[model samples]
Target: MEVYVELTYCMNGILFIMTYEMISLLLNINWSFLKILFLSFLSNISIVLIYIDYLPYISFLYWIVLFLFIFKKQFFLYFPVFLIVYFSILFFINTLIKESFIYNGILITPINYKDIVIVVMTCVFLIIETIYLIYAKRKIKPKDDLYDVTLIFNNKIYHLSGFLDSGNHANYLGYPLIFIKKSKIDTYQQLDTLIIDGLKKRKIDIILVDQVLVNKQSLRNVYIGVLDELDYDCLLNKELMGGII
Candidate 1:
């Protein structure tokens, strides 16, 4: 709506000039502006090829909103990284699949402004999706009743509400915090090796390991792993919403 609006033209006598809307779109970009522009152009072409024939009149703003919400926080940081890694991986995979055992190549394609918008939008969408996934993982409040013999898995330590019993006492006369479960540990070798390695330089020799969640449940026949920590200092404290101290 301003007088400073401008335009550009393509080779076919049509005004293929940059518009005010496009300029406004680019205004918010900071450091990775040029790279963003290039990637955006590429994605627009892709969207056209995929949806142009069927969904004839799709608005650019719709894609923008979708991408912005999904990847609001990580858009700038991840977009360039995604572009670089995606192309590199794609090229390597394509070369591996081809008859030629070796392929060293370059990707050179013309940029269309529309493509830039789509790529940026899609990048934002993926970023938001990633955030949502992480949020979900964090939101999972682990239940105490579901576990027995919690473990200090290297850096992260977990607490388990373990059941103590006999038949499951498989410790070879060591300081392993043993527990009883009705199931078996799958790939015991790998788990043992991991626990052993975690305890090699620590204050403990072995661990109190076994399994948890007996049959007729979701976690059936699960072989639990644990290790002894010397300076194993991880604690969780909780307080009421409005309580002090």
Candidate 2:
């Protein structure tokens, strides 16, 4: 009985660590393997709640605390999303393993081939996660159209991922216009406004930043159009690269 419980704990720890790492990569967050391992270890400790019959509630609360610690300001936004996806993948893998054992006529007992099932389940989970991560990375960020951008405004330096958009030819008084995500920048006094003709005619605020760096090339006095509907962090103007590429 002790051996069975120990094996379950260790296998669960491995799964937790892998899941966190996979989610981090998918979200474009840089989390070290060692840090994830440590957090997973702590999370696995909640398994002890099983002895007191408080396993489910305590385990859920413990994981919520950990997620809050890791995600900080984005806790509320990311926790529910992560929880749903994580459990869905977990349920799929669990069902797969159970069906495989039943089809093979392998009886799962605490001291029987349960260990083998757990190990095989973890391996299968890793394989599925690897494939999904690779596919998501390519689809979410295509290297050809993305650029590394640095914005210096209000004496603060901000690094962002920019998408090169050829259609964004809007300019203001000769200076090319660059569209940025409204949430990325703090609230600033709106200097002026520009009406953009897209699917709908919408007026966006125009603000001037001190300097903008697109793919390491610096451009000064560029007009910035803040859009609430921007998908990427920044949208690079094709004309902005005319003089400096």
Q: Which ten residues in a row have the lowest lDDT in candidate 2?
A: 100-109
Please give, for residues 1-245, the per-residue lDDT of candidate 1 as tens digits. Answer: 11110111111001001111122233432223344434344333333322344543342333344445545655564444444444453354334333212111212222345533533554465456445444554464334423233343333434544432222333333422343221222222323433232312322222333322222122212333333331112111111101211
52-117, model 2: which lDDT tens digit per residue?
553346667777888777666667766776676556655654564443221111112233476476
How do all models score by TM-score? 0.25, 0.49
The models' CA-based lDDT, in order, is: 0.31, 0.70
Task: Please give the distance, in angstroms, between residue 25's alpha carbon in candidate 1 and its true position after superposition.
Answer: 33
Measured by TM-score, the strongest candidate is 2
Candidate 1 worst ten-residue window by lDDT: 8-17
